[model samples]
Target: EEVTEGEEVERKEHLKTQWARLEAVVGTKARITLIARDLVKHFENRLAALDGKAMVVCMSRRICVELYHEIAKLRPAWAAEADGEGRMKIVMTGSATDPLDWQPHIRNKLRREALAQRFRDPGNPFQIAIVRDMWLTGFDAPSLHTLYVDKPMRGHGLMQAIARVNRVFKD
Candidate 1:
């Protein structure tokens, strides 16, 4: 049955209110720091044993970068000044016009391709990748066993994101 315009407006207003509440809680620095610590603990206790890699799907590019830094603070070895040398890296595309702080995490096409190659290698030190949207589809790494989703996703996009960890790896 077709709904009235009033219902559509009500639904939109409800969704906006929900999103605002979610952002208020999740976007806080304290919450992000707690999440970062939990992620590190989870990695150490579980994924590290299997020699597995993980992906962190964040709400946005800004959150992706913030979470990367928070995680890095807990594990300095995971952070690298150079794009090509980090164990934990953010894979997002951005232009020079974007915020200066975000520039380091942003990469050109070739650099992203290189990061993709490094991530595909099971033996490589590159283990955890933080991303907003780039690798949610058309990317595969068999050794990846965990997906830490801090973002809200649904339907096809959600399916594709979770499927990143579903590829068959060795026994």
Candidate 2:
């Protein structure tokens, strides 16, 4: 059957408009966990993709120290371990140290490694930290919900963190 030219144009225009509307509403980061100052606009949109659930966080060491102090003393449990239930673990991935004071960079790496080992069973830990490292894009874990970033990231690095929580799970 011969197709009408006007009908084709009209259909194409309708589809284009619909696509634009859908994108405007969802954006890029919708339905994933977020790590930022506010949870209003970007974070909330991402949360929609998640359908609102719990997630684990792999945090950096320096930031973890501060977070640790607050969570332990301020509102929730004091110990890093969750009491009588599954607790989030911190896998602060880092390297070794030389002379303990020979190089500032070396010292920093040591700190990160120390933090990663803190959790012991990082594969299953709910909370973890990674200073000077990235794990969200490639690493897969069921409970990894939140990504508390305290480092500078842009371009592909940003995309990885957003992908971390979009993974569909049965739990």
Candidate 3:
């Protein structure tokens, strides 16, 4: 059956409305807080005994920062003001031009490399890494046992992100 031009337009409009609604729901502060609380609960109750690290893949840089703060609030000991002192860290790349709140997570190449090295170590306190797009591909952390994806990813991107936790690691 052929779709009339009027029907096609109607369908497009309906899709646009749906997309807007989804964006509204997803961009709310309450939803972010809820997700943060649930993530902390999952980590403490489920992923704690795995003796491995976890990565959280967020939809955007802003969400990454917000979620990180929310999680930090729930688990104060998991957060630190300095990069060298955090159990949970945001590992996204950003610039000085970005918001001042993001400056701590925005590191130079050497700092990023240091963070990467720490993340690769199974015994390091740096366990949870909140990221937008940096370590999704061409990065390997065998000790990474859990991946919490809050972003919409598909095709090769999705596969690579999931593969972050698929590495072989000894108990």
Per-model TM against the reference = 0.86, 0.40, 0.84
Candidate 3 matches the true fold with a TM-score of: 0.84
Local accuracy of candidate 2 as per-residue lDDT tens digits, 1-171: 011223577787775666456534432232222332232334346656653323223223444333433343432432344222233323343456433321222324454344334333334322433333434456554444555554444567667766775655545
Tell me how far the alpha carbon of residue 26 in candidate 1 is from the true structure, in angstroms, after superposition: 1.3
lDDT of 1 by residue, 11-111 (tens): 87777777667766787899899999999999988864688899998876778888888998999999996866879999998989988889988888999
Worst 10 residues of 3 by lDDT: 1-10
Query: How well does candidate 3 score on lDDT at residue 90?
Result: 89
lDDT of 3 by residue, 51-148 (tens): 88899988677888889899888999999977778889888778889999888778888888899999999889998999988898999999898899
* Error in Å for residue 60 of model 1: 1.1
Ranking by lDDT: 1, 3, 2
Q: Extract clashing residue pairs from model 1.
A: none
Q: What's the lDDT of the predicted structure labeled candidate 2?
A: 0.40
